[model samples]
Every structure is written in structure tokens, then in C-alpha cells.
Target chain A: MLLPYLLLGAILFVLGLIGFVTRRNLIIMFLCTEMMFQGIILNLVAFGRYPLKGAPTFDGQVFALFLIAVAAAEAALALALVVLLYRYQGTLDANAYRMLKDE
Target chain B: MPPHPISLSALLPELILLVAGCAVLLLGVATTAHRRRLAPWVTLLALVTAVVVVLFEVLITGRATRPPAAGSGLFYGSLATFVRIAALELGVLLVLVNWSAGREEERGEFLALLLFALTGLLLVAPADNLWLLFLAVELVSIPTYVLVVLSRSNAAALEAGTKYFYLGALSAAVFAYGLSFLYGVSGTASLAATTRAVVLALRDPNSLQGGLAMVGIVLSLGGLLFKIAAVPLHFYVADVYQGASSPVAGLLGFVPKLAGLIAIFKIIALTGFWDTENRAVYWLLWLLAVASMTVGNVLALRQTNIKRLLAYSGVAHAGYMLVGVLAGPLAGKALATDGVSILGNGPAAVLFYIVIYGLANLGAFAVLGLLRTRGGPCETLRDVAGLLRREPGLALLLALAMFTLMGLPPTPGFWGKFALFGSALTASRLTGDTWLIVLVIIAVLNSALAAAYYLRVIAAVLLYENDQPAYAAPREAQSIGALLCGFLILIFTFYPSGLMRAGQHATRELSEPRATAARTESPVASAVDPPFASP
Candidate 1:
């Protein structure tokens, strides 16, 4: 049962990683990162249910709680930033802003 | 000695910061009817308050204790306190430097994030358990992800924030993987117990768990090294600095790097490999220090953008400090002829160097923040050509910043480098290694190399023909802020004793000699081990 949850989390995380990397839309990319964070939560909760050695520990659950809080906070600010960028540049395409000239 | 609960008093500074940060966020919404300019000032007030409370706590409490957790309590002591003071002071200075930019948008979110980040760093210095360290590092880092994107008016700002978040998450994952390896090796995450296990592994190179633990330590360093913008992980730093405003760039570069370096110091110190017998730890840090210095300087040499150059320069500085940490751990014990205090001396030098470096870096960033054009902050070398004619005072401030950064005479930076180099030199002498001395020479030479670019800016301001470059106009706030920062740089040069004394006091707690210094000995040293376990 725990293994199934872990597998689900792994798939979600991979999908989110792909979306974040391949997508051009800044907001969608950010959403994908949040999706990846959810995957982390899933893994943490599953681990909380079934400890590696014996009895379940609260460490995994506490960590998961922090992750959820952080992710929520992150999404709020990230979305706000995306909105601000669109206002400034009139677009959400991540590729258009390549002004940082690398030498 | 038995287990005792972790003290809440030890966590007061973080509590104060969190409460203030939440207040700023709440006021961000509640004060909609107030003028937008009021929010940043309020945030600034909160930061100042946080600093005062931290100062009071450190000065009044004298010492705060953390209970020994199974995995994280090994990094506790004055070393952590001193580092927190240095890092938090940098955060406070950042608020002052970037006030001109933060005020322009009427956004207090930056202030809240800045306070929150400092809170995280404060917690990081004292984290004794690996799990605690993990949580604390995120506490420091997650807010920064928000800070990067809080000022959303510009395309560059948003792009920088996005890239930073992506990279930050990757680093965090890498860190977790390393931590997992550490947990597997020691069967416990506590640094005290883990050190014993690691020593066993080191003695027998064939040990799978030891090899895995080492890889984990290295991988954990990857995430931290990224924050400090060190070699192999520094690619993101230049881009992020170029895209962010000068103030954000300054905070992004300085605060996190200080936190990372302190964490690195704790990690190195706890591993028990700094002793001469620990050949592996010495070799690793020696290689890391040299690589960081050479790469940062060489890469910085080619940069035209001032921000990019500074970013690379920061990486180089981290390398130099790592050398000090290596020296402190590897040779301090062996060199203790007649109980001559080499242990205190090495770590003391590192702490002092951090304070001096923080001051000088903050001063430089303050001036750079002032040099912003109406469009945004200027990034190019050519943008500062005629600055001397219009703002001689600001030019002088930049000159002082450059001289200090170059580690030139009479400045705190000079003494700071002298401390670091002197410790490394002494360590090499005691350890019978010319290679460490060679690393010092490379560091000094790189300082000279650093002088070229720092002086380039000075020359551009003072000696270059006064042809007005684009966006060379100075705002009133920039002038005032530069003047204040200039005074600070100058003060640091003349009155270095006060800061040095503070740093010295901060390291006084961990300077004891251990009878059981060998790995086969007891897990925790008897010198300052408390009787209670943390609940």
C-alpha cells in the first residue's frame, strides 16, 4: 500500500519536472513546480504511515506539513510575480527575456 | 549526562523575526488606505527591531543552549552564534542599502522575506542535528524564493526569480539525497554519533557506508555551494545578479553565502577530519578551496557587467574562507605546542574574516544600489564613467569600497585576509605542507587580481574623462545611503577592534581542548557537554 503511494508520487514528480522544464509559459512552469512539491508531500505522508524500520514517526509528517505550508506560500508569491511580469512585458513566455548576456 | 528539552529562549530571535514578518505581511494588506511609501519604512523598522532584539539577546543572555538531538546538535556553540550575528547584521545592512529600490515600489514583502531569511540563518548556525539543519536551511531559502519575485514590475526581475526557484529546488533535492546517505551511514543523524561512524569508515576505505556518507556530504555541499555561488554551481549566480536589482543582488549574494559558509564550517568541524590524521577531509577542503578561488577569479576577470563581476568575486571570497576553515580544523590541534591556543586562533580568524567581509560587501552593494538609473540599476562598467564629477562623495565611497574589497592596507578587509592567510600559513607550517602555503599565495595573488576590477570602477569614477554615460543620474536616496555606507566602511577600517572583540567573544564557547580527540574515543567531547538531553 505504501509502495503504491510512493510510485504515484514518483510519477507526479517526474511529470511536474518535465512540465517545468519544457513549458514556455511562466505561470504554468511555476504551477508545475508546485505540482512537484505535492509529490514530495505524498512521499512524506506515505513514509509517515510506514516507517523504514518499525513504528511510524512524526518527523516525516512534520516535514510534510512544513512543505505544504511553504508550497502554498511559494505559489501565492510566484503567481503574483507572474502577474507582475505580464504587466511589465505584456507576455508570459519565459523564452522572450534572454537579456542576460553570457560571456 | 541525560537528555534535556531544547530551550525556547534559544529561539527568541527567530520568534521575534517571524512575528514581525507576519505583521509586515498583514500590514501590506491592512494599510491599503495609507500611502504606499509607508509600508517599506514600516518593514525597515521591523528589520531594525529584529536586529536590536538579536543584539540584546546575544549580549544579555551571553549564551543560549540547544539540546543534543540524535543527528543535529553537533554544530552548537559560540561559533554558530558569532556566524548568526555576522549574517544577520549583513541582512540588516542589506535592508538599508536596498531601501531606495524597495521604497520605489512601495512593497514591504522584500522586508518580510529578508527578515524571514535572517531568521532561518539564525537557526542554521546552532543546528546540531542533520534534520534540524535541513529544516533551518529551507527556512532561510524558501523566503528568498519569494523575495526574488516580490518586485514584479520588471521582466528581468521575474525571470531571475523563476530561474532562482528552479535552481533552488534542484539544490534542495540534491541536499536531501546527501542527507539520506548520511542517515544511512551513521544509523543516526546526530553529528556527534555520525562523526564516530565516519571515522571508522575513513579508517577502512573499503567500507560501503563510509563511501556513501562521503558522497552525501559532497552532494549536500553542492546545494550550499550553489548559494555561495562557488565553482560548478556558480552559473546561476551571474545571471540572477544581472537580472535582479542591485539591492536584491547584494542580499542574494551576501546573506545566503554567509549562511552557507557557516553551515559548511559547522559540517567540516563536526566531521573530526580537520585533525592532521584525517587526511581525506584535509585533501577535500584543500582541493575545494583552491578550485573555488582560481575559478572565481579567472571567471570574474572576463566580466564586463559590474554585477556579474561582483558575483564571481563573491564566489572567490567564499573559497578563501573555506581555506581558513580547512586550516582551523586540520592543523590547529597538532600545532598546539605548550597549549598555545591554536584552536581558538583558527576559528577566531574565520569568524573575524566573515565580519570584515560582510561590512565591505554591504558597503559595495550600497553604492551599487545608489548607481541605478531611472530604468533600473545600471549593470555595465561603462555606465559609471562620469560619476566622479557629479558625485565626488559617492565616488570616494566607491573608492573606499574598492580598496577594502581589494584587501588593501589599513582597512578591515586587509586585517581579515591577514587573519585568514596567517592561520592557513600557520596550519601549513605545523602540518608540513607547502601546498597550503601555495594556496595562500594563490589567494593573495587573486586578491591582487581582484584589485584590477575594483580599481577599474574607481578609475572609471575618478580618473576617466567625464563623458556622461547612459543612466548615470543619482537619486537623492542613493546619495544619502552611499554616504552612510561610506562612513561604515571607514569606521570598520579605523575601529576594527570592537567588531573583532565581538567576534572573539562569540567563539569563546568552543575553544576547549578535548582529551578524547581520537575517533575511537567517546562521541561527545567532555569540554562543554551538557547534562540534559533535549526533548
Candidate 2:
């Protein structure tokens, strides 16, 4: 019963990882991380419904709530950094900000 | 257990830091003019108070002296006490380093963020559950992202901040996903409960439950490796270090790495993975240790920018510490030979190494922060030419720091590396693992290779001559701090016993839970009861 949900969560996580690696836009990369969080949240909820023991408990769901809070806080910081980067560099492209790299 | 009643007194240091952070932020809003003058002092006061509290808890009053409630779940163990004290001491040093840097207007915010980060670090060392661990990791990292960007308003700082943020966010996501899987399999978030559940699941290695848990371990560890600045996740380090100011870079270099390493140690101990059928995790760590050392040193040899060079060197140091991690105690007693057990020394060696590394690395950055030109900080090797002739005191300090980093004798780094590599050799001999022996050989060779670059920096300061105008004289406070760090490094070499004793004490405390968990892992009890359930 839980197999399909677990599989879906795994797929979403992989997709998010791929998107994060392939995307160059600062905001897009952050969104991909959010996608990854959502996938994990899905798994947490599913696991809460089908716990290993006799009765399903809310521990996994509670953990998912905490994850959401942390992700939201991270998003706020990410957007602020992105805005600051754009203000300084005049672009959101990750490739444009390569001044610190070795020549 | 009904979720043991939380004890505020056991959490005094973190509570004090949190209040201080808020007070500094509020003071900034209330008294704008005096905010700069008041902030660092307030932060210092908070750090001193926290240190005193930790000292009382660990040394004066003692762990057993605390109330019963104070010794459970979130607040237990001398390991937490030791790590918290270390983090507080490092926080105190970082605040001192940043005392004169940054604009006056942002000083309060800077101190506040630093305090918040220290609070997070202190919380992390004592976190008993996966949820607290996740929160503490984010709390430590998010402020650092702000600190990096706020170090300067330039495009470079912004770029570094963006890169750090994106990668950091991704790593957090990966960690959360991995945690979900673990929670799914174990049906609990408490370390003890999860450890119990995973042990039973892994008894049957080919089961679906065991497979999922293995994935959980790898993914979560991958997330943590980013924080430790290991290979494949270390690409951002050089750029970030170069972009951030020297003081902030110094904090970033050590604090997160310390927290992450301790967290990893705790998880590994709890899971008892070393005793399980899953030997693949051991090899994965072995590969990372070797790769980080080789890659960090090889690339560092070509770097001209001093900051970038030290960044790579920091990465290499992480590799060395990972060797200590690899040498951690395995579960079974099969490897024990002749009653000489070397298995448990890894954590202690790592603890000792972090203190030495923190002093040397932070001291080096302090000197770099001191030698700023009109444009900005003097970063390249050429920029420091003839420094010995111009500023003998600063030059001597930098040279000492460089030599210590190279693990030369009569410095703490020598003893630090000696203990770490010794532990690795001991583990290899005890386990009769040929691979660990090879890893130790690579580590020794990497240490020798690393000396070349560190020596080149020393030579630039001592031997080369440049007609460039004399560098600006450093502020007295900053110079004194760096000098103090240098003095400690030199002094500790002759008297390493004190530090080693502390390390042993902390490591013993940290390993107790695992030892107990292993003894109590009866299949019937674990299968019948959900250990984490509230009564």
C-alpha cells in the first residue's frame, strides 16, 4: 500500500536534484530545493499514515511541519540574497558572478 | 517516558545567548548612535556569561549535580557540555576578531547574527532528537549566509552569498528528505528509538526496511559532508572565503565544520552502523577522506591568493579530520587484540584536532584581516612581500601560524596531527584493515605535500622583498588576539595533556549511549514497544 507513495516521493526528490544541478538561475535553484522539500513532506505524511507499528502516530507529520517552517525561513533568506546579488551584478544568472574563481 | 520534562537550567547558556542576541538587535533600534559601541561589548558579555555557565555545568557543579530532569533527552551528556564550551570560546574569539571590522551602522546586526549562530551551535551539540538537529543545523547556517553577504556590499560578496545559499539550501533539502526516510522506516525521530529500530531491521540485511535505511544514511551523510566542506561539495569554499571579509571567513572556516563533525559523530554512534552488515558506509567515508585531502592539497599548490590558498588548506584539514572519523570505534569486539583497544580514540583525536586547527586557522585569518590596503584586504602572496622587514611583529605572527598549519614541530598542529594519524594507525592495526593503512599513508603524504604551500606563504613574508609601501599598522586589539592565538599554539605543544584529557572525557561520554544501546538491543523488546512513544 505504501510502495507507490514512496516511489512518487523518490521520483520527486530525484527531479528536484536534477533541476537544482542543471538550472543556472538563482531563484530557480532555490525553487528546486523547495520542490525537494515538498517531496519529503509528502513522504513524511505518507509514513505518518502507515507507520510500522499498530497505530499510526503523528511524529512524521510533526517533523514535516518543522521542515516546512525551516524551508520557509530558508526561502526568505534565499530571495533576499538573490535580490542583493541582482542589485550588485545587474543579472540573476549564476554564470555572471564568477569573479572569485581561479583564473 | 512521557517526554522527560524540559529543564531550563540545563539549557542556560543557549537561553542566555538567545536573549543577548535579541537584546543587541533591540538596542540597535533604540539607540542608533551608540549601537556600534554597545553591540560587541554586549555580545562579549553574553559569550563570557555563557562560558561561565558552561564551566559551572561541566567543571564546578558537575553533570551529576544537575537535577534529574536536566540529565535526559535534550540536555544530557558531558560531550554536549564540552562542545558547547568549545563553541562558546570560539565565538568569543570570533567576536574579538570582528570587533573593529565592518561599518559602525551594521555592527549590532553583525554581533547579533554571530550570537544567534553561537546559540545554534550550542543547541546542536546537545540536540537529542532528529528534529532538533535539523533545526539547529539551519539556525547555524542561515545566519552565516547573511554574515557572508553583509561582510561587504560588493558584487563578489553577493555572488559568494548566492552560491553558498543555493548549495546550502539544497543540502538542507537532501538532509530533510533523508530524515523522512529514516523516520518512515523507524516510525520515530528520537535517536535511541531509531537506533533500536534500525538495528533490528538491519539484522536481516536483504529486507526492504534495511535497504531504505541504508539510503537514508548515505543521503543524510551527503548533506552533512557539504557542511564539513568535503570533496564534491567543497567547490564553493574558495570563492566564498575570498569574497567574505577575513573575520567572517575565519568563523565560517571552523564553527560550522566543528558543529557538523560533532553531529556526524553523534549520528554514527547512535546508528551503530559500523557493527552492522552495512560496511559500504565505511568505504564511502574512506574515499571522501582520501579525496578531500588529495584534491585540497593538489589544487592549493597553484593558488596565488592567500585567502583561496587557506580555504583549500581548510578543506585538506577536513580530510584529515575525516580520517579520525574513519577510525571511530566499530560495534563488535572481534577487532580487539591483546586488550589494547584503539577503536575509541578517533573521536577524542578529532576533538583535540579541532581546537588546534581552530586556533591556527583563525589566527592566520586575523593576521590577514590586519594587513589591509586602501583598496581592500591584502590577499595575494605578492601583497605580503617584505612583510618581515616592514612589520616584524605581524610577520613573525603570520610565520608562526603558517608553520603551525604545516604541522611543524613545537606547535600544537604537530601534536594534533600526531594524535589524529596515530589514531588512524591504531584503528588500522586493530582492525587489520589494509585499506585504512593505505588511507593513513595517503594522509601522511598529503600532509607533506601541504607543507610546500604553507612554506611558500611563510617565505613570501620572511624572504621576499617588495618596494610596495608599508602595509597599514593593525589595530592593537586585533594584533593582541592574533598574538594570543599564536602563543597558545606554541604553548600547547609542550603541554598537550590537558587538552587530550578533556578530549578523552568528552569522547567517553559521547560513546556511552551507543554502548548501552548495544547491550539492550533485545529483539523482543524493540519489536513489541515503540520506544519513542509518549506514555
Candidate 3:
């Protein structure tokens, strides 16, 4: 019963990681991180039902709830930063900001 | 399966900071100009109050033992007091470092956000639940991403903030993913319970639970690597450090790294991997330590920008602390051997090193923050040339900081590195792990190599001849802050015993219950509690 949900969670996590690494757009990369969070939250909730050891506890669900709140807070901060970056560069390209190099 | 009890009194400092942070935000947002001016002072007031509360707790809590179920609850005594006071003390230095960092309008937001972040850092030491730890760690960082941008108004600052936010979010997700697995392995979120689970799993050498724990730990470390700016996720360090103003750069160097180290200790101690001996976890930490040290030092060699140079140096410092983490706490063994319990306490050395490192780094940045070029801060090494002639007092302090960073004697940094690496030597002898000895030797060599760049900073200030960058509008606080850090370094160098004792008491049975402390009397207790932390 838990197999499909865990599989989906794993797939989403891998996909988000790929998107995060491969994407050039800053907003998209940020979104990819959020997607990864969603996957982790799903996995956490599923684990609450079918713990890997001993008797199950609702702690996984509790963890997922805290994680969701944190993710939302992170999203707010990420979007604000993206807006600031866009204002400075007039584009969302991650590579555009080269002002902080070693030279 | 009773619920772990929570201790609200142990959580007092955080509560004060939370209320004060909100008050500061409200004051900063008030329509009156005077109310806005009150924000920074409010933060200061809050910090002082929190420090008092923490000290009081230290007095009252006195080697306070946790309930047997505290493995799943917050640790309320020694370790909490150690980290909380350290965070607050250094936090005040951080605040002074940035007294006039950005425009006046940004000061309130900056100080308020800093208070919130400190609140999070204080929570990490006592956090016995994985979920609580994850939240606390995030709380420490999310505001800093904004604080970095608020530190300056330049396009570079904005860009730095953007990159910092993205990476921080990604790392948080990765860290949470790992936490989920840790929960699965134990079917509980309690750190001690997880360690117990790991102990149970290790009973069966071939168990998948052990393998699963390893996977969880690796991924979690992957996420946390961003905090310490370890090798794998250290790409953001130089850029973020270079982009932010010096005061914020100093803040970045110390606070997040401390949080990461504490959390790593908790998780590793959770698995009892250090004691039980897990090959995959062991070697992973080894690689991270070696790689971070090598990469941070090699890359720093070519950087001309001072902030960028310090940025790389910060990474290398993290690598050094990682060595201590890898060594784990050996105070128990040292007591059995020679009565010098401080000798082998790896975590104690780490605590001492961080305090010394934070002061030196903060002092250097405070000195830098006192002057600004047209491009912002004393950017290139050339800007520092003949600074000794132009500003003897400030230049001398910067030189002193560099000496500390180089771990030279007459500075506490020497003892910091000596104690840190000495613990590794102790670990090797106890474990009969010869590779640990090799690792310590390599770390010593890295310190030697680190001196070359640190010398360059001193040489620029004292040796080279060029027009020194004209001091920006002098802020007395920055100079005073720099001198204060330098003074503390000198004091610690002379009277190291006081702080060293604190580090020892703070580390003893830090993660384990009284049951574990009692077991330490036997020389082979390590045979029971043996390894901690991955690698």
C-alpha cells in the first residue's frame, strides 16, 4: 500500500534535483527546490503510516507539518530574493550576476 | 513510548529573543523616526537580557542530568548553556561589527533579523528531536539570506542574497529528506531514540536498517555541508562572502557554521556510528574533512580580494573543525589515562577553536568594516598596504587576527589548533586507527599552508608600501569591536584554563544520558559507546 507513494516521492525528489542542477533560470531553480520539499514532505507522511522499524508513530506526520511551514517561509524568502535579483539584472538568468568573482 | 517532556525554562533565552525580535520589527516599522532608531538598541537590550538568562540557567542547572527519556527531549543544562552563551557573546560582537554596516534605514531590519537568527542558533544545542533540529537550523539561516542583502544596497549584495537563498533552500530540502529517512530507521524523531535504534540495528551486522541509517546520514551531511561550507557545497562561500559587506561576511563565517557543527554532532551521536564503527559513515567524513581542507586552501591561494580570501579561509577553518568532529569527544578516555580530561576532548577543542576563530575572523572584518574604498571595503590586498603607518592601532589588530588565523603562538588560535589536532592524536591512540594519525598530520600541514596566505594579509598591512585606503567615515563601534575581539584573544591566550574548562564541562555526556556518563569510568567504555559522528 505504501509502495506507490514512496516511489512517487522518490521520483519527484530525483526530478527536482535534476531540475535544480540543470536549470539556468533562477526562479525555476528556486521552484525546483520547493518541489524537492514537497517530495520530502510526502515521503515523511508516508513513513508515518509504515515506519521502517518497530511500531509506527505519528512523528513523521508531525515532522512533515513543521517542514511544510518551513518550506512556505523559505518560499517567501526565495521569491523576495528573486524579485530583488530580477530588479538588479532585469533577467532571471542565474549566470548573469558575476559581480562577486575572485578577481 | 511515553512522550518526551519539554522544559520551558531551558528555553527561556529563545523565548526572550522571539519576543524582542518581534518588538524590534514593530519598532522598526513604526511611523515615527525615533521608534525606528529604537530598534537596534532594543536588539542590544534583548541580547544582554538573554545572556543574563543563559548564565543564570548555567548556575541553576549545574551539571543537570536529563530524564532517561531525554534522548527524545531537549538537553537543558551544560551543552545548552555553553552554546547559548557562546552564540550570544559572539552575537554581540557581530552586532557591533555591523553597527553602521548599511544605510540607516536597513539597520533596524538587519538587527531584528539577526536576533531571530540567534534565537534559532540557541535552540540547536538542546534539540533532541530531529524535527526540532531541522526547524532550528532553518531558523538560523532563512533570515541571514535577507540579512546579507540588507547589509548592502549594491547589485552585488542582491545577487549574493539570491544565490544564498537558492542554495539554502535546496540544502534545507536535502537535509529534510535525510531527516525523513532517519525517522524511518527509528520510527521516531527523537535523536537518542534513533541512536538506540542504530545500536539495535548494529546488533545485526547485515541489517538493512544500518545501511538505511548510513544513507540518511550521508544525505543529511550533504545538506548540512552547505552550512559549514564544506567541500561539496562550498561554491557559494567565496561569492557570498565577497558580495556582502565585511561585518555580514564575519557573521556568515561563524554563526551558521556553529549551528551546522552542533547539528552534525547531534545526528552522528544519534547513530552512535562513531562508537559502533560504520565504515561508510567513517570514510565519508574523512573524505569531506580532507577535501574541504585541501580545496579551501588551494582555491584561497589565488584570491586577491580580501573578503574572498577570508571566504576561502572560512571554508578551511570549517575543514579543521570537521577534523574535530571526526575525532568525536575523547574526554572520557583522557580522564582514564592521565587526569587531563581536556587533552582528548575533540568537541572541546572544536568549541575552543570556534570561539578563537570567531573572534579573530570578526576582528579582521570589523577592522575592514572601519574603512571603505570607492568600490566598498578595502577590496584588494593593495588597499591594505602601509596600513600600519596610516592606522597603526587598527592595522596591528588586523595583524593580530591574521596571526590567530595562522594559529601562531602568543595568540589563542595556536592552542585552538593544538587542542583540536591533539584530540585527533588521542583518538588514533585509543582507536588504534593509524589513518586518524595521518589525517592529523595532514591537518597540521594544512595549517602551515594556511599561514602563507594569512602572512600575506599581515605583509600587506605591515610590509608593503602603497597609499593605504582612506578610512571611511569612522564608526567608533567597529574599532572598539575589533579591539575587543583582539583583547579577548590575548586574554584567552594567557588564561586559557577558564574557557578550556568550560569546553570540557560543556562536552561531557553532551548527547548521552547520565547512564552513558557513568559508563565512562571504565577504560573500555569507548568499546561500548566507541565511535560517534560519521567519519
Listed for each candidate, the true contacts retained, as a fraction, are 0.14, 0.62, 0.67
Candidate 3 per-residue lDDT over residues B186-302, each given as its tens digit: 777766566777667756656777766766787898999999899989999999988888899999978898899888887777667656666667798888899999899989888
lDDT of each: 0.67, 0.79, 0.80
Q: List candidate 2 segments past 4 Å from native.
A: B64-73, B274-278, B330-344, B515-535
lDDT of 2 by residue, B254-345 (tens): 78898789778866755575555257778888999999999999989999999999999988999999998888744213333342333447
Off by over 4 Å in 3: B1-7, B60-72, B202-206, B331-340, B511-535
Question: Looking at model 1, how many pairs of residues clash?
Answer: 18
- Candidate 1, superposed: residue stretches over 4 Å from native: A1-96, B1-4, B31-37, B57-76, B103-106, B330-346, B372-376, B469-481, B504-535
DockQ-based class of model 2? medium
What is the docking quality class of candidate 3? Answer: medium
Q: Pick the candidate with the highest lDDT.
A: 3
Give the least accurate 10-residue stretch of model 2 chain A, judged by summed lDDT.
Answer: A51-60
Question: Candidate 1, which CAPRI tier?
Answer: incorrect
Error of 2 at A84 (Å): 1.5
Query: What are the candidates' individual DockQ scores?
Result: 0.19, 0.55, 0.53
Candidate 2 residue A72 Cα shift, in angstroms, is: 1.0
